[model samples]
Target chain A: ELVLTADMLVEGVHVPRHVAPADFAYKALAVNVSDLVAKGADPTLYLLTLCLPKHPEPGWLEAFTSGLSNAQADFGCSLAGGDTVSAEGPVCLSITAAGTLPAGKMIHRFSANPDDKVFVTGTIGDAAAGLALIRKEVSAHPLSGEGAMREFLLSRYFRPHPPVAAIELLRQYASAAMDISDGLVLDFTRLCAASGCGGIIEADRVPLSPAVSALLEGDAFSLEAALTGGDDYEVLFTAAPGVADAIRSAAESRGLSLHCIGSIVREPGITVVGRDGAPMQISRPGYDHF
Target chain B: ELVLTADMLVEGVHVPRHVAPADFAYKALAVNVSDLVAKGADPTLYLLTLCLPKHPEPGWLEAFTSGLSNAQADFGCSLAGGDTVSAEGPVCLSITAAGTLPAGKMIHRFSANPDDKVFVTGTIGDAAAGLALIRKEVSAHPLSGEGAMREFLLSRYFRPHPPVAAIELLRQYASAAMDISDGLVLDFTRLCAASGCGGIIEADRVPLSPAVSALLEGDAFSLEAALTGGDDYEVLFTAAPGVADAIRSAAESRGLSLHCIGSIVREPGITVVGRDGAPMQISRPGYDHF
Candidate 1:
C-alpha cells in the first residue's frame, strides 16, 4: 500500500520569525516523515513547495537546501521535485511525502482493542518544553543555566527525531498507532474516540527526559504543562498485552525506548491518574487552531 | 509510470491581492493539470497545501473549496489529502499533482528532432491580454466596452482551459511536449535548449482569439506582448512531419484546434519571423521571476 501525507509550516505561526533556515527546513521535512512513520510506511520520495519572503538574506536558501539534503539522507527519501515562489509575507513551506508498505499492514488509530496496552516511543513533552523555552515562557536556569540541557530542549523543537527506524516493529506489533504531534493526552483521546473506547494514563509512568525531569523536580515546570503542550513527534501506539514483552524486546533490539504508559478501556473518555491514584484535571486538552 | 508536478501561487506575486478565491483556487489546480497534460499523463489525484492569511474574510474558504470541487470534477481527479495552516503574510497556495501513464510513454521536452514540426493547442495570448485588462494596463473599450468580449478575456485569465483532453493525441504524435506557461517564446526557447536544437516560429501562424485579435486591430496591444506574456497554460509540442496528418485528424476528431506554428531546426537559437517573412527581433522573450 502507498501512503501519502502533506504538511505545511508557516513562519511566525509554526516557527519563530527569526528561526535558522536550516532548522526550519529540517523540521518541515521531519514532520511529514513522522506521519509516514506513524503509518508503518518507509518514506521513499517527497515534493517540496517553498513560498519565500521577498529579499531573503544571502545564504538562507543554501542553508535551507543543505538541511533538506541532510534530512533526505537521514530519512532514506529523495527529493523528487519542488516549486519555489516569492511571497509578500512570511516564508511558507509545504512538503508532500509518499511511502509504501506491505499491503494491509497500515497501522490505524481506530483499530485499538478495549484491552490493548498503550505504548509510546521515546520521552514525551520534550519538544513542547523546547518550544516553551524558545518562546521564553520557561527558563532553563533550573537545569544549570544555558548548557547542554538547554540546547537539548531547543534542538527537540528545531529538529525532531521521529522513530523512522521502528517501522518494522510497529507494523508487526501495533494494533493502532499515531504520532504524538499534538499533546499525548489529546492525541490519545483522539485515538480512543476513533476506536470507540476510553483510556487511562498513569501520570507517573509517562516517560520524561532528564532535562524535563530536572525542571519538574525544581518546581519550575508543571506536569500539566507537559501533558497539554504539543509538538512531540513520538509515536503512540497500542497492542495486545500478551505481546508487551515481545514488543519491548524488539524495541530494545532496535535501540529504542518503549514505554507502557496507559491502557485502553470500554469506558468512553480519557483519564489521567496522579501518583496519589486520583484523577487529574486538564485545563486544556490540546492545541486547536480554530 | 507515475508523474508528479508542483506549483506555488502567492498573493500579490502570482495573482492580485484581492482576487476572487474561486478563481484563485481554479487557477491553482488548472496550472498543475496543465503540467500533467503536457506530459501525456492522466491526472489521478492532487494534494493541496493552503497557507491562508490570519482571519480570512467570511465565505472565502467556502468559495475556494467550491472552486476546487468543480475543478476536481472537471479534470477527473480527486483530492487525496492536504494541509491548511495560518500564514502571517498574504495567502500562499501550493498543489502537488500526481498522474500516471504507461511506462516508457511519458513525453519530454528534450526529445524533439531537428526537423520536427511544432504545434500548439488552441489560441495563445488570450490569457495574457486578459491579465492586462485586469491590471488596467490596457482597456477593453476597443472591444465594445464591458460586454462579452470583455468578459471573455477576463474569464480566460481567471479560468485557463488547458488542453487536458488532448493528452492521447499528444502522447501518440508528439516527439517532445511541454506546457506553455512562461510565454510562447521563452518556453519554446527552453525546449530548444534542452533538445540541443533551434526553432523558428511564423508570426502569422500563431493562433489568437477573436478578442485578442480585435484588441490588436485597434492598436491597443502588441503581438510581442502576446508572444512574451506568460500564463497561457496551453500545450506546445513538436512531432515528426510524417505524422502531421495523423495528428491533425486526431486533434480535429477530439474537437481541438491544433495549429502548426513552426519547425525545429539544427541551428542553436530561436527565431520568430514576422508576417513580412523576415527575422523579427524580440525585445523580451518571456516572464522571468528573477
Candidate 2:
C-alpha cells in the first residue's frame, strides 16, 4: 500500500528568516519522513516545490541542495521530481513524500482500545525548549551559558532526528500511532477523540532530556511548557498491555528508549496527574496556525 | 506505472493580485492535469499545499474550493490529502498530481526521429493575447470591446483547457510528446535538443483563433508574439509522416483538432519560415521566470 503525506514550511511562519538554508532544507524533508515513519512505512521518493522571493545568493542553492541530499540519504528516499518558481513574498517549501508498507499493516490513529497503554519514543519537549531559547523567551542560565547542554537543545530545534528505526517495532506492536508534531497532550487528545475514548497522562513519567531537566530543576521553565510545546517529531503510539515487555526489549535491542507515559480510559477527556497525584491544569493544548 | 508531476504558482508572480479566486483554483489543478495528459496518463489523485498570507474572507475559501471541486470532477481525479498553512507573504500553491498508465506505454519528450512531423493541439497565442489585454499592453479594439471574442480571450487566459482528450491520440501515434506551457518555438526547441534533432516551423501553418488574427491584422500584435508567447497549455508532439493521416483521422474521430505545424530535421537548431518562404528573425524564445 502506498502512503502519501505532504508538509509546507514558510519563512517567518515556520522558521525565522535568518535560519541557515541547510537546516531549513533538512528539517523540511525530515518532518515528512517522520509522518511516514509513524505509519510504519518506508519512504521511497519525494517531490519538492520551492518558491523563492528572488534569485538566491552565491552558495545558497548549493547549501540547500546539500542539506536536501543528506536528508534523502538519511531517510532512504530519493527526489523523484519537483518545481521551482519565483515568489513575491517569503520563501515557501512544500514536499510530498510517498512511502509503502505491506497491505493492511498500517497503524491507524483510531484503532486504540480503551485499555491500551500509551507509549512514546525518545524524549519530548526538547525542541520546544530549544525554540523558546532561540526566541529568547527563556534564559540559558540553566545550561550555564553555552555548553554541551545548550548545543544539544539548539540542535534539537534546528535538526530534528525522528526515530526512523521504530518502524518494525511499531508494525509489530502498536495498535494506533501518530507523530508528535504539535504538543504531546494536544495530539494525544486528538488520538483519543478519534478512538472515541479518553486518556490519563502521568506527568512524572514523561521523558525529558538533561537540558530540559536542568531548566525544570532550576525553576527556569515549567513542566507545562514541555507538555504543551510543539515540534517533537517523536512517535506517540498505543499498544496492548500484554506487549509492553516485548516492546521494551525490542526497543532496548535497537538502542531506542521507550517510555510508558499514559493509558487510554473510557472517560471522555484527558486528565494529567502531577507528581503529587492531583489533576494538573493545561493552559493551552498545542500549536494552532489559525 | 505511476506517473508523478508537481507545479507551483505564486500570487502576484503568476497572476494578478485581483484575479478571481475560483479561476485561480481551477487553473492550479488544470495545469497539473495538463502534465498528466501530455504523458498519456490518466490522473488519479493529487495533493495540494496551500500557503496564505491571512485568513481568507468569508466567501473566498468557498469560491476557491468550488472551483477546485469542479476541476476534480472534470479531470476525474480526487484529492488524496494536503497541508494548509499560514504564510508571511503572497499566497503560494503547490499541487502534486499522480497518474497511471500501462507499463512501458508512456510517451517521452526525447524520442523524436529526424523525419517525424510536429503537431500541436488547439490554437496558439490566445492566452498570451488575453494576458496582454489584462496588462493593458494591447488595445481591445480588435476584439471590439466587451463581446464574446473579448470574453473568449480572457477565458483562454484564465481557464486553460489543455487538450485532455488528446491522450489517446498521443499514446497511439506520438514519437515524442510534451505539453506547451511555454511558447511553441521555445518548447519545440527544448524537444529538439532532447531528441538530438532540429525543426522548421511554417509560420502560416500555425493555427490561431479569430481574436488573435484580428489583433495581428490591426497591428496590435505580431505573429512573433503568437510564436513566442507562453501559457498556451496545448500538447506539442511529433509523429512519423506515415502516421500523420491516421493521427488526424483518430483526432477527428475524437473531436480533437490537431494541426501539423512543423517537421523535424537533421540540423541542430530551429528555423521559422514566413509566408514568402524566407527565414524570419525571432527577438526572444519564451518566458523565463528567473
> What is each predicted model's overall lDDT from 0 to 1?
0.90, 0.89
* lDDT agreement of model 2 with the native: 0.89
Worst 10 residues of 1 chain A by lDDT: A82-91
Model 2 Cα lDDT, one tens digit per residue, B1-290: 88999999887877677678888888888889988888899889999999875767678778889989988988899999889998667778999999888898799999999989999999999989988989989988866544787789888888898787998888889999998887888999999999999999999999999999989998998899988898888999999999999998998899997999999999889998987899889889887777
Which residue ranges in model 2 land beyond 4 Å of their true spot?
B144-146
Candidate with top lDDT is 1
Docking class of 1: medium
B1-290, model 1: which lDDT tens digit per residue? 89989998887878788889998999899999999999999999999999886699999999999988888888889999888887667888889999999999899999999999999998999889999998888988789555898888888888887888899998888999999988999999999999999999998999999999999998888899999898899999999999999998998888998899999999989999988999888999998775
Question: What value does DockQ give for candidate 2?
Answer: 0.85
Best by DockQ: 2
Candidate 2 local Cα displacement, residue A83, angstroms: 0.6
True contacts kept of each: 0.81, 0.92
DockQ of all predictions against the true structure, Cα-based? 0.77, 0.85
* Candidate 2: tens digits of C-alpha lDDT, residues A73-129: 889999999989986667789999998999999988988888899999989899898
